[model samples]
Each structure stands twice: as C-alpha cells, then as structure tokens.
Target: MFPKIHALCAAAACAVAASPAALAQQTLPAITITADPRADRGALTVPDTEQAIADIERIPGGVEVVPDTQFKNTPAQTVKDILERVPGVFAQPRYGDDARVSIRGSGLSRNYGNRGINMSMDGIPINTSDGLVDLFEIDPTAYRYVEVYKGANALRYGANSLGGAINFVTPTGRDAAPFEGRLDIGSFGYRKAQASTGAAGGPWDYFLTASAQSVDGYRDHSDGKEQRASGNLGYRFSADAETRFYLNLNRIRQRLPGEVTKDAALNTPQAADAEFERLDQQRNIDSLRLANKTMLRFGPATLEFGLFGVHRHVMHPIYQWLDYRVQDYGGFVRATDRRMIGGFHNEFAAGVKVHNGAIDTDQYINLTGGHKGNLAASMYDTSKNLSAYFENSFFIRPDLALVAGGQFQHAVREREDRYLSDGDQSGRRRYDNFSPKIGVLWDLDPDWQAYANISRSAEAPTFDANTFATPTSSDIEAQTATTYEVGTRGRRPGFTWDVSLYHARIENELQCLTTAPWSPCTIVNAGRTVHQGIELGAEFAVLESALATGDRVWFNANYAYNDFRFDGDPVYGDNRLPGVPVHILRAEVLYKLPGGFYAGPNVEWMPKSYYVDNANTETVDPYALLNFRVGLAPAKQGWTGYIEGRNLTDRRYIANAAAAGVATPASALFNPGSGRSIYAGARYTW
Candidate 1:
C-alpha cells in the first residue's frame, strides 16, 4: 500500500522541480514581518522568549511556550520539572534522568527510550533518523525556553506524528548572564553543578555552558552519572543577514533497575529486579553534535536554513549485551511571508527537511558483571526520510481567520543481517503519507480567542519497534489517525486559562505487548482504536496585597482526562488501553511576600487505577503525592537559595508500567515511585 503511494510522491517531486511556477515563486522578494514590534530584528537571529510566546499564542490549536523562569527557582532536573504546568504532556521519571514521556497517549506502547514524538534543540532535530530519542542526553539547565505544538499543529516543524513536536530554545549572549554558577544537593546522594559564560562584542557573540550530575537513585541498583556541554557562536554580516554555529556533547552512564512485580512495587518499593543485579544491567552513551544556521532577509520574505550532524555510541547490557554506533545527518530550509494579499491579511509558512542515518549493532550473551560471553547477532540498519510542509492563514473578516496546512513525508527503512545464524532476517520497507489540516480562529477580544481544527496524522514504525525476531516486523505497519479539536484560551487581569477537547479515530495503531516476564516486547499493529481526552490549564490570583504592598496569593492547576480504548476489535473488544491513567491532576498554591520571597504547596493526584494488559486483568493502584517548596527569586547580581520537599507523605505507588498481552499477578511490569526526599540549591550570577 505504501510503495504505490511513495512512487506517486516521487513523480510529483520531479514534476515540481521542473515547473515554471516553482521558478517564479523562488524569484519573489523576501520581506521581514513580525507580530511584535519589541522583537529583536537587528542583531539576534532568533526571537527571544517573550516574542516567541506572543507569536505562539496566535496558533489556532494547542500550543505552549514555557520559559526557564518557571522552574529556575526549584529543582530543574528533568523534563517533568520544566513541563509540570503544561497540560496534555505526561512526563514521569523512572530513575535518575531516565523518564517515560508521552503526549496525547502517543508512544504509550514502548517502555524504553522515546517515540511517537519529535524532539529538537535550537530548531535542530535531536531524535535519530529512525525516530528514537535518548532522554538522558537532554540537559534541562541548558535551555532558555521550550515550545510545544500539540498534534498536527506542529506542521511548521515538518512533524506528522500523533504527539507533535517540542523545541528547546537555547539562550544567546545578549540574554545570558556574563558569568553564572549553581549547585544543588538532594536526598539519596544526589548532587549537581553548572557553570556558564556569555559575551557579545562587535559582530561576534558567543555563549558556553557545562553541567554535571550524579545520583544514587531511590531504588536499588539505580545509580547514574552524566556530563554535558553546549555552546554557540554567531556572526552578523548586516542588519538583515546572520549565521550561527552550535556544538553539543554528552556523556552518560546509567544503571537499569528493571521492572518489578505489583506486589514488590507497592510493598518493597526500593527492591530491584534480582536478575538485573546479577547481570549488572546498565546503559552508557557518548555523543556529539555540530550544526550551523543562517538567516537571510530578502525584499518581502525571510529565509532560514540549517544543517546538522550527530555521532552517538551506545553500550547497553541487559538480558543481552548490545553495542550500537550511530551516525545521523540532516538539513532544513524554511520560508515565511506575512503580507497583504487581495487586500486581506495573509501569512504563509513553508519548510522542507531531509534526514538520513545508519546504525551498526552487535549483540552478545551477557555474563556476570556486564561482560560479554558469546556473540549472539550482528546487523546493520539504515533509514532515510524527507518531509515538506506548509501552512497559510487568510483573514476572512476583521477578527476571524481561516487556516490551512499539510505535510508530505516519504521514508525508507532497510536492514542487513550479517549473522546468518538468525535466519538471514533482512528486509526493506517504504512508507509515505500526505496529512492535511484545516482550522478556524476567532478573536473574541483583545485578550481572548477561540479555535477549532480538524487534521490527519501518520507515523512510521522505528527500527526498535520493527526488530525483535526479524529485521522488520511484517505485521507492524504505519499508524494513522484523524483528529478533531476545539479550544479556547484567554488572559484577564487576575485570571488565565487554556482548555482543549479532542477526539481521534486511529487505524492500525502500533502496540508493543510482551508475552513473558523480562522479555523484549514485539511490536504489532492493532486493528482499530479510539483516543479522546480533555486538557485544562488555569491560573488565578487568589488574593492581592494579602501580606504586603507587592504581594499576592496565586493558584495554578492543570488536568488531563484520557479515554483510550479499542474499537470493535476481533480480540480484546472495547478494552481500555493500558499505559496511561484515566485522570491526572496537578495543582499548587503559592504566597508571595516582600523581597522576592515565595513559598508553595503542590499535589499530584491520580484518582483512578488503570490496567497493564490488553486483557485488563491486572491493575495498578491510585495515589496522591504532596510536596512543598520555598525560594528566593534570582537577582541579576546576587545569590539566591531554594529548598524543596517531595512526597511528604511517602506514599508507595507505581510510577510507570509496561504493557502486556495477557498478564498474571506475578508479571513484572511496574516501576515504583520515589520515596520522601528533600532538595536544596543555590545560584549566583556576576
């Protein structure tokens, strides 16, 4: 089915390459138009956080811009901390920096690494060409802000996945402190430190930062350490042209505690799977990336282009000792035009991305203490993908707009099995799709808006999902869905709110269901499924001038309701999906006094239990966690301190679980949550 479609796409590409219309469009002049006049248009090549937020709010769907200031006063250790207030995003830590992050129930099948979502740093792809993400390599302290585009609204980034896209924007010399240092210490032998410096002079500007952390995790056999460094250099040729070069490096080592039974998870929360300790399971990675971005402003449009390359090496030891070396490279070009068309306000954005990568894998029998005994298998895998996307907004009325967009993507997956002992498992697959979107936006007032959109999304299976017993799982196919969404967001004098409701009808949904304990899961295609949910985010000023002249009481909360289940399937009819909880709520209240001081209490509650298998026989329990924190806001040139306590009640509960086809009580599928702990930190800038 995909090969035929891909052939048509190839023909279309060739025809467009030789068309006169394409040539005429390329000759048009470039113009610079911005929604915010305060945006820096001269020296900086990228918009600042404030300008970015202002621009993102114009989207006709779910989108968020999270600034680093929201988490700088607390323990900014993981994605969970940085995205805590963002609705529809579920990020939970398993141990150390390793986490299970999903959006709108996307990637709920795979238990390791990240899938179903596109991750980027500084507008460059961070995931491999095969769509696998190494979460441990992401350093939370290195970013100035993050942008999240939910579902098909991420067409601007050429992402056509169910979960959409996340971009981490780094700080520039102009916005960064000249010199800064920070230190953090916490329970369970956790410690971290960071240092940074930035400077701009004449036409040259630079920013550099490095961080290191170590943790003896809450569970046994879950100790880990990591170090990272990132920097960028920018050069300005004129007021309308600029170029920047970036470098990033990471070294990580983590111990795998493995999953435990439901009984052990709730009773002996600190216990590690016995097999994991005996085999000394662990994962270590070394990676480096180099990238370059340039911006050119012509007469009426803005053109941006960039290229990047990454090298990653992994050493993983579990039931089998796996060694992998990967190389990936990509390039992208984007254009934006904001001008009057037919005397109506119009905006158009278009982009194309090309990514290719290869991986060399070797597997061996695991010996005690993470040593290799005998060679088990060897294989080589390669992937290539191309994506082109465009979006246009045309004002039909003074306060109303119609938005349209689509993405065309093509991909090729191939594998070569060097070890013939594994039945010569070699194959190739081709996949392609054209996803379309249409939406409407109405500006209710100067500070409020309402939006509705109907869109389609598609995702091809990654190599990890395809390779268990063969080079490619013939039964595993691409997942596709059509979604309908409606939402409203606004900000009043003392209140802010963002709410969205969505429903998706999916076909051939990919799922990973293991059959045995501690066995690798095999990816399969589910016949049909339905995913529907609601996302809510709100903040209120409970009281102003409660204690002092410039003090206030603030209440902030976010909620997500997931209703995912099979739809008239031949087997497991109408059974709910097993990975995510039915309902999740997070809320906090803080009191601010004089002198940049604030204190807050927060709660994370999951009131309903969920199943862990397609049969819906085994279930996880529900629980709530209480936490508190007090801190002094960071000053430009002085020291600030903060202290936080989490899980004050020490509730024992399951944090994460892997799915299974049919589960028994003895099935080892649960990961325990952390116990009570306290953390403290200090920072200084000069």
Candidate 2:
C-alpha cells in the first residue's frame, strides 16, 4: 500500500486530489488496510479502488483515479460534474447529458460527438468500432471509480488516439453494500433516483444497479429523460481463477436546442434556435451491452481475456431524419509478469485487441414535429480494427525505473451506398501505424515522484468524417503526432500537487474547415499543427483549527494553459485554434468541521476570450461563474444529504463553441451556459 499523505488516510488524500468536490470534507482518520476483510478478494478480476490507484501510479505519464465517494454529494448527472476537477481535462455541458470534452487539445475540431479519445468500461470498449462516443449512455452513479490515462499513457488499453482513454470500473458484490438508494432534485424540474444491491456467497458474487432521471432543462427544447441498468455476476473456481459476466442497458431521449449566435447566446440565453424549434429536433437511443471476462494467476504471472458485444438503435431528427442500427463485437487478451530479471526487479505486460462492427444507416427528409418524409440516403458501413501492444518497467535502482512500450494497429473502413439519388458515394480506406514510447521515473521519496516521456500517437478518421466530409474522394489521411512531456507529483504536510508540461508536433491533423451556413462543416487534413500546454492541480490546508472548534479550512485549485495553432497554412497562416481558450482556472475554499459537515464556494474562470474561426476574425467573450455547496458527507453507515447552488450570479456566458473556417457575428456557433440554479440530494446505505 502507498504511504499516507497526512494524518488522513491515503485513500482520502488521493481521492481529494482527484476531485475538488471532496477536498473540504477530509475528516476521516487514517486506517490500516491489512485489517480490512475485503483485501483478500481476487485482485486480477476485481481489485478495490486503493489497489487501482497504486497500479495507476506505476504508469510513467499523466493518470488519475477518482473514487465515486468524492462526488456523491453533488448532482452526479453529467461527465462534467464528475471530471471537471481533473487537470488537463476540458468538459463543458451543452445541454442535458451532451458535453464537449477534450484532453490536451484532443478533439478540438469536433463540435458534436466524441473523437480522438477512447472510453471503456471494465476494459471493454464502449465506443463504436469506428470510434464514436455517445455521452448519453454513461450513468455517473453506476461507477465504483474512474481511471483516466492522458495521452500515450493509455498503451495498456491499446489506445492510439492522442487523447488517450478513460475506464469506468464497477463494484463487485464482494465490496459493495447490500442495499443503497438515493434521490436528487434540483431547479428547472430536475429529478433523479437510483437503487443498487449486491451480495457474495459460496464463491459466487453479484451486483445490480438501476437509475432513472428527467430534466425540464434551463433552455427551450432541451428537456431530456433517461434510464440505465447495469449488473455483473462473478464465479471463482479457486483462489487464483475467476470469471465474470456483465450486462448494461440504456434508453435515452433528448431534445436539441441547436446552436445560437453570440448575441443570442449572451442576451437571450434561454431561447432555442428558431429553425431547430420549428423542425422539432431531437435524439433518441436504445442500447444493450454484454461481456464476459476470465482471469487466472500463475505464481509470477497473470492472464486475462474478455469478449464483448453491443447492439444499439438510434433515431435522430435535425436537418433530416436519421435512423440507424449498429452491432459491434470484440475480444481482448492480456498477460502480466512480475519477477527478478538478472538480479533486477522488472514488470512486463502485453495485450492484443480486435474490434469490428457494422452499421445499417438511413436518412429521410424531415417533416414538422420530427416526422420522417421521403428517403434521402441509405448505406451499410463496416469497420475493423486490430492492435497489439506491450510495455515493460525495469528498475535500475531502488528509487528509479525505466519504462518502454509500443503499439501497432491496422484499421479498415468500408461504406456501401444503397441509395442512387446521391450518386453512390461508396468508398474504402485502410490505415496502419506504429506508436512507440520511452520514459524514466525517479522516486524522490515515498510521497513524491517525477517523470518524463516521449511518445507518438495516431488516429484514423471516423465514419462521421469519412462520409460527410468527402463526397467524391477518399483521400483523407490519418492524423499523427510526436509529443514530449515531463511532470512531478507529491504531497507535503499541508499541500499536494500534480503538474505536467507537454509539447506536440502534429502532421496531417484533422480539421473542419467550412463557412457554409446551415450545412455540415467539411473535415479535412491540415498540413501541420502544434499543441502545447501545462496542467496543474493543487490543494492546500489553509488553517487547521483557528477557532479551537476542531474545524479546518482547505483550498483547492486546477489550472490549464493551452497554446494550439496551425504551423503555417496558405489560407489561414499561423492562426490560433478556434475551439478552446488559452487559460482556464477553477478554485475553491472551504470550511469543515470534524463531524463531516462542509461548506465552500468555487469559481470557474476563463481569463481571455478565444477565437471561433480559423481566420481569427470572430471570438467568443470570456466569462466567470460563481457557485457554492454545503453538505454532510456520507460516513461509515447512515443517511447523508447536501444542497448546492450554481451560477449564483446568473452570468450569461458562452459555454461551448464550434469551429469554422471563417465566421461572422451572425454565425450560430455558440451554446450558452445555464443560469442560476439550486440542487439538493439525499442518500442512505447499509
């Protein structure tokens, strides 16, 4: 087990650093892990959260583990609500469950849907085979903990995207409570409820959870409702062997307000776009996932394998009516060995993954009230991907280790157009690439460490870009980048910090460059670009007990500095990237009593406005938000509750913006943030 950060438990300190929402409530005393009965469970198939954190620390780059306890008191409804405290991550909600998320400048060109990143659950890919993520499928309350691997550090998962990967780990019956329930209600007619139960008996374990939520949204035409269910069953043949099965289902419906002009976004922030309201735009989806995994231990080595399948149906109405059905299946195998090699401590791991999927797609003319008219397009799309990766860490001395790894991937994309009206836009493309990484880690002490790494990343275009961006050609190339990074993390008596600096040189970067109104922007490959930034996360204990009342004061902050630009293009020259700002800062100060009650105020600030067009002719104005929370955190066993307020100042600011080649003041490209609101919740467990 890792050493404790202070008088508090290592688990509490690490969890606090990962989520600012938990910073002020650190009143739990340190406890020894050996006395815990759950420690003897199978580590390979289902390691506890502390073990997960220790494993993540072995990686020589940016990574974090966030326990669900850290955000339990808040309205854990969206990714932004749970992940916003992690440095180097950008998550801004547009409306309902949809958010524009990116890491270290990844997916800057994508305004809707996810790209340049990989998302998984229990090591199984949640993204479609062609690399698209639907945020609506994730239920924040279902995860036991979340693991974030930024950039090339995600080699363990065979991820090749520049943004790396995030894995949501679920609890097993051996570690969960027998029964748990929660309810949350907030402004704008928001409501959510969840129930879960788990148990273990005679080498058999099971866990199940279900949730339902609805929101009348702060924006017109943006209301949504969703339902989710997840469960897992595990069987142990012996102390060293186990197998588990998982099932997940989701039903979601969300109305789209669409984008608004800067003036409308800042002035009439609550109004929906006229065209979108007239057309009654909406998105609805039904999806199911099933998987099985097995693990076996062999003294000095462990082997794991798994297979997963997903089925989804989507109905979307915007400019047109889109109906699609997708079926995806894949499998992975991995092995890890730890032992002494030539009298030196060494650890090695290797894995291979294969993912394939097919989609039946249809588009029809749109009628009023989100009804379908005549058929506009029909196609069958298929994707195949295969990747193999390996990593090794060799200890040179008691306090130093050298790490090296690499991944090779082959991918194929094929589209068969069945509709003749669009003149058969069928096409085929293949991509192959190898990425390598090298790093050095030095332990300054038990509580501090420093590391440096150089790595490469590559990403292939998804079907979204392959189909809509190029109607008559199939020439878009893969995006690739080489990056150099260095960082340090440590904890002292009263402070903890994690910081990293990185610079990347990219080639054939994917970008959307179009100025047409009411049409999809065309994605293209840029000649060259650069992404560089600093990520900083820190927390400090301000006053231990100034009033002699056993109360404490804490301060927590996260700051990201981004500098992204095109190297030199004939049309745009060396202009700044359009989507993200240069500086983002979030900070909070809180007062806590020894009994678990805490109160705090926080702020989110963008110091300067950023451009919205590649030409740098138009910009989105900078803004700041003020919020506060007061809650009694959950203890060993009992009922807990919290009240939270957001945007207390009712600031009218742009929350998200899309990229364009050139734009005017009239361009409808910005999404407004929600106004002042309040939320409250209660939970009980036994």
Candidate 3:
C-alpha cells in the first residue's frame, strides 16, 4: 500500500535526517490510509484512471486494468462475473465458480484445470510451474483490482503462455477500509460471508481477508463449499526500501454433476448423471502459498526481487480416485530504470525468473461411499524453468516510442514411474526457446494512443496434458505461436474505447480429443492453426442533462469476433476450431444517480453456432441471455445492497461443451446452463 504523498514525503524527510541505526530504532506514529486531499478528484478506489491506463498502455499490446468497482457490489463470486465484459477473454461458469476460462482460445480444449494463462495474486505467481491454474483456489472477494496482460504483452513478467497473465492485486493497508463485512444469499441455496481489515502503524502495515461460501448448485449432485483466506504484512525499512510477505490458503470441495446429452440438458436441466451420483464424484483441494517481495530504489533505478513456495493436495474422483500432492518453489529479480538518455526519454527493464515443482501422484479405483478400492498406479513428475528477459523503450519523438525485447527460456520435464505393473513408463524431455518482441507506440494526443506489436510465445505440455494410456512423456511437442497485433485506445469526455485486431499462427497446437465423458480428455497435436480475432470495448454516457446532475445513463458493450481454424490439416482441413463460439457480444444499458443508485439491463449473445468435434458433424445452438441488476451504494459509512437476476427469460441453453475426437451425440459433452435465478447481497464498511 502506498500512503498519501504528504505522509510519504514526511516519512522520507525523517529517514533522510536520521542515521541508519537511529532510523531503524525509531518508533513511528500511526498512519491512516487515505487519498491525498489536495489531489484532483477522480473515480473512487484504485489509481487514477488516466495514469493507470497509461501504465498499461506502455506494454504496446492488449492490456487492461479492471477496478473492483466494476463488480464488487454484485455477487462477486466467479471470475466470469467480472470478466464477461472484457474482450478476448472467454470465461464461462462451469458447475460453480469454477470456470472454463480462456484467452483468445488459448485453453479452449481444456475442460478441467486451467492452462495457457498464467495467474498471479498481488504480483505473486499462483499457477504451478507446469502451467496449471485452478480457479477454485481463488477467492473473488480477496482482490481489489485485476490487471490483464493479453498475449505477449506479459513478457515483462516472464509469462510466455499463449494467454499471457492475469494479476489479481490485493488491497493494502493504505488502500483498504479499516474493516468491512459482507453477506450474500441467492437462489439454489447459495450463501457467502466475507470479512476484511487493514491497519498501518509506524513502518508496519498489514491486511487480511477471509471468506466462506457454499452453494447447492442448480443441478443435482453439484453442491460445493469453499473456504479461503489471504493476508500480507509489510515493512518500510527506509524511504527508498520496503519489503512485504504474503500468505494465502484455500480448502475447496466440489461435486461433479457430469455432462448430459443436448436433449436431456434442455429438457431436464436439473438432472445429474445417475452414475455420477452413485459414485459421488468430486474434486477437493487444499493448498497453501507463502511469498515475499522487496523493493529498493537507487538514484534513477529500482530493483524488485521475490521468492515463493507452495504446497497443494488434491483428492478427486473422476475416472478414478486421483490423489496428488504438489510442492513448488520459485524466485525472481527485476530491475527498472526510467530516465533520460541522450536528451530522449527511455524506460529499460530486465529480469530473471526461476520456478520448479514436483508432483507425487497416486490413483485408485473408486468403490463407493467415499472409499478407494485397489491401487491403480503411482508416479513422480517434476518440472523446472529458467528464463531471462530484457525490454527497453526509446523515444523517437516527443510523442512516440520504439520498444524491443525478447526472452530466453530453458525448461525440463521428467516423470519417474514407481509402479512395476505400469512397465516402467518413464521419460524425460528438455525444451528451449527464444521469443522476441518489437513494437511502437504513438501518442495521438493526451486523450488517445495508437500501438502495434509482433511477438512470439511458447508453452510446454503439462502433467494433465500427458494423460496418455501409455504415459509416455516425450510424445507431445511444445506449442508455439507468432502473433501480430495493432490497436488503439482513447478517452474523450464521457466516452472511452479500446479496440484491437490480432492474428496468430500456431504450431503443434495441443488439441484435446475425448471418446466418452467417463474418461479424461486425451491430448493430441494439430498440425498448423490460425487464430485471429477482433476485440472491442466501448462505453459512453447516453444521458446526463435529461436526468439530475451527476445522474446519467450509460451504454457499455464488448464484442469479440473469433476466427480460429485449422490451417491445411490433413483431416480437418480449414475447419473451424471446436469449443468457442465464433462471435460473442455483451451489452448493458445502465442508469446511475449521484446518491449511489444504479440499475442496468445486460445481454449476452452467442451469434454463431460452434462445432463440437473436428469432423464438424454436430454443433451447439446459438443462444442469448437476458439479465438485470439493481444496486444501492450510498457511501463508505453506510450499507450497500444489490439484486441481480440472470437468465431472466429462463432460456434452455447449453453453456459449454466438451469436444470429442469422434463425432457423436453420445459423447455426453453438453453442460446445461442454469435457468432463471436471482441473487441479493449486502455489505457494510467503517
């Protein structure tokens, strides 16, 4: 957390006047977290929009910073709740808060456990070294802001995955309210309660948040519960140096409703597979993470370094009683210099990151009543990655800058089979790649900017992607892509817009093929594929003077046009990729008042039917959903309340589908969407 400018200056003065020993021994006074009273007024919470967006725009590609105000007052339980309006981000809720989250179709083929997209909490990596992220481990209420770096824009963080990175930043003592509490109750036996607090004293600051939630899902055998907590402690050793430690824990238990046929999904939306109920199929996880970060400032440069460790245990029963324990640790260091070079402005940055992890896995046959039958097999899997990167921005003109950078990565994947019955199916592989990026940014004016960039990215196979019947590790190749993008973002008066066009040529694409729902999806390689999309977002005030002062109507909308297809494949030549829709659009008409009353009607429409297999024989129907929300948030000293209704038309739709290798209806690939439901919540702050 950063204090007000005055308080920071005062602390800096004291530090400069005192000797090192004296400063270390001094007892400082308590400091309240608040914005600088002397600064110009702006939107509440988070950094000022212009400055923050400027920081994001420096990446020269698709990037955004979504503030908490966008979805905080609603049922902020799922990533889809907030990400639905972000262009290029395709996230749909699965049974619970678990989502099929993908970026530009990066992980479209994955149905369970996340991949392609790197995830972080407050600048600390949350994804395992093997490129797997679990959405259930994240507590929606734990974050105050979310920073999205799409595609190669994430090179600064050593993220080479196709989807780039998502950083959920926590509130610090200087930014959070002293204490806050919230409770939410909704349809289908949903309930949630969360509490958070923050405090700062002398050189010490601390912030903590805890939440518990449960839901009897719309479909039978889909109930789930989760508990999560996160906190951070910080110390400012001097005006130019500071360090922070972060801790996070999660315990999650979720049931699997199992997929059904399209007819059964629409006719009996609440039905669950009988076998799933009999077997009591479920996925449960317990994970803990600890991390530390330190920042030190020199004359014209700053240095940041950090270390992190994680311990995770998973007890799940899907095709089999899967038990896995993961231990991962990593560290990173980064240096940044923002200074003038030979009469021109220059921003230079460089970093090195190392991450390694090992997994101890065991499987057993599922008997019944939460019991494991015979031992199936056992294996030990490990992964390690080391990367170095550098980037620099050179001002060619007062309003233009040229950026060039690249990263070199060395990684290894190994598996040791311990079960003799498995015939010693063990292997090891090494992957190395050098990705490069170059871009240019021109400040069209103070209110807008135009940018363009080209970059290369690479991703290695994960343990989950190695679910071959033979368990051979070297069978799959790393996925690679080369992308070219151009974009423009601008703000004028009461209107703002962000638009970009991008195309990527991918090789050795990791494609998933499944024959039956009873089995895990199989990973295979597709020859060459092309992914191109139009990502657009715009919002503007529609009415102001017609209503009361400071009261207005706004129109917000986001549209994504996906054109992903196979490039001259031998079998599925020129066929569109299965899974994601061809086009997705979301729009909202919102009315707001100065006293904090707001109401909006929103719609989500999938205009193009998408295929369910490479053969393109079967396809999911196109559908649209109508939703509405109303809320009241007076101020920090009062109660805030909201009412949200989703799928108000009670549309019988299939929200997502799992693709199969062989085209057939009996694949049990369709997951039904929830019917009409209403949710209400309230919160208090002091």
For all candidates, the clash counts are 7, 0, 0
Pairs in clash, predicted candidate 2: none
What is the C-alpha lDDT profile of model 1 across 423-531, one tens digit per residue?
Answer: 8877788899999999998878665678999999999888866663543465478899999999988655555678999999999888877777656777888879999
Best by TM-score: 2
What local lDDT does model 1 show for residue 347? Answer: 80
Q: Which is the better candidate, 2 or 3, if ranked by lDDT? A: 2
**Per-model lDDT:** 0.82, 0.83, 0.79
lDDT of 3 by residue, 1-686 (tens): 11111111111001111222332343211111122221122211123433354456666788877766666777877898767767999988879778888898887877677788989887678888888888998887677767788898998789887899988888767567899899999998899999999987877878899999999999999999999999888787766677888999999999998878778888998999777887789999999999998877675677889999999999999778889999999999999787777888788899999999999999899877657989998989999999899998888787788999999988888888888686876778788998999999877876567889999999988876664347453478889999999998765555567898999999998877666667778778787999999999876667774567656676778899999999999988899888899999998887776677778799999988998888888788999999998888766566888999999999999998887765676667888999999999998888
* TM values, all candidates: 0.94, 0.95, 0.92
Ranking by lDDT: 2, 1, 3
What ranges in model 1 sit over 4 Å off?
1-43, 468-472
Model 1: per-residue Cα lDDT at residue 606 = 94
Model 2 lDDT tens row, 52-111: 766777777888777776666689879887688888888899888888889988888666
lDDT of 1 at 632: 75
| Candidate 1, position 461, lDDT | 86
Q: Give the number of the best model, judged by lDDT.
A: 2
